[model samples]
Target: MAEMEAALLEIIKNHAVGLTGPLTRETPVSDLGIDSFAVVEIIYEVEEKLHVEVPFNANENPFGEMKSVGDLIDALQKLAKPA
Candidate 1:
């Protein structure tokens, strides 16, 4: 989970802006000013880098449930874990 979180933070740092403070699991993506396009880019990058398919629908409300970094991490962990 730590590794995943670190990777996520790195990706967010590369794509988003106006981050006020150090990012935490509780930190909201909206607080980091991540836009819709950046979120998609982040998802793509995460999928490619982590070598895991995110079971997400792009047409739907992708960020509807993911409010914080921890939420995303949890989702990724679940999807990436071996069945």
Candidate 2:
């Protein structure tokens, strides 16, 4: 979980936004004020960085559809965990 959180922070970090506090599961993506395009770029960056493919496009999300950092944690978990 910590690793996934860190990975998410790394992605968001590329956009020049601070994490508010630490990267926690409850942190909202919208609070960072990252626009849609930046969100997609971040997601794709996560995909490339962690080498895990994300099914949905982050740009499709607005109003924090992914909800919280925990959602991203779930994403990474699904991608990296064995089936």
Candidate 3:
């Protein structure tokens, strides 16, 4: 989870423009000021890097349930685990 979180943070930092504050688990995606397109790109990057298929629908409200980085990480962790 820590590794995933680190990778996620790096992806966010790379994609998010003009991010001045330090990103933490509690930090909301809204705070990052990333648009929907960037969110899709981020999701794609996560899937590619982590080698896990996210059960999220990118065409839908991708960030609707994912308010914070922690939320995203939790979802990814659950989905990444073998059934």
Clashing pairs in 3: none
What TM value does model 2 have?
0.60
Estimated TM-score for each candidate: 0.76, 0.60, 0.75
Q: Please report, in order, the local distance difference test score of every candidate based on alpha carbons.
A: 0.75, 0.64, 0.75
Q: Extract clashing residue pairs from model 1.
A: none
Give the poorly placed runs of model 3, Cα more than 4 Å off: 59-62, 81-83
What is the Cα-based lDDT of residue 51 in candidate 2?
Answer: 70
Error of 2 at 20 (Å): 3.9
Please write out the lDDT profile of model 1 over residues 6-79, one tens digit for every residue. 98778777775868788878888688787777777887888888777777776877566888877866766675
Q: How do the residues 1-83 of candidate 3 rate in per-residue lDDT, one tens digit apiece?
A: 67877987888778867567998888876788788788778777888887777776756665568888778667666765422
Residue 64 Cα positional deviation in candidate 2, in Å, after optimal superposition: 5.9
How many residue pairs clash in model 3? 0
Candidate with better TM-score, 2 vs 3:
3
Candidate 2 residue runs with Cα over 4 Å from true position: 16-19, 57-64, 79-83
Arrange candidates, best lDDT first: 1, 3, 2
RMSD of each: 2.5, 3.8, 2.6
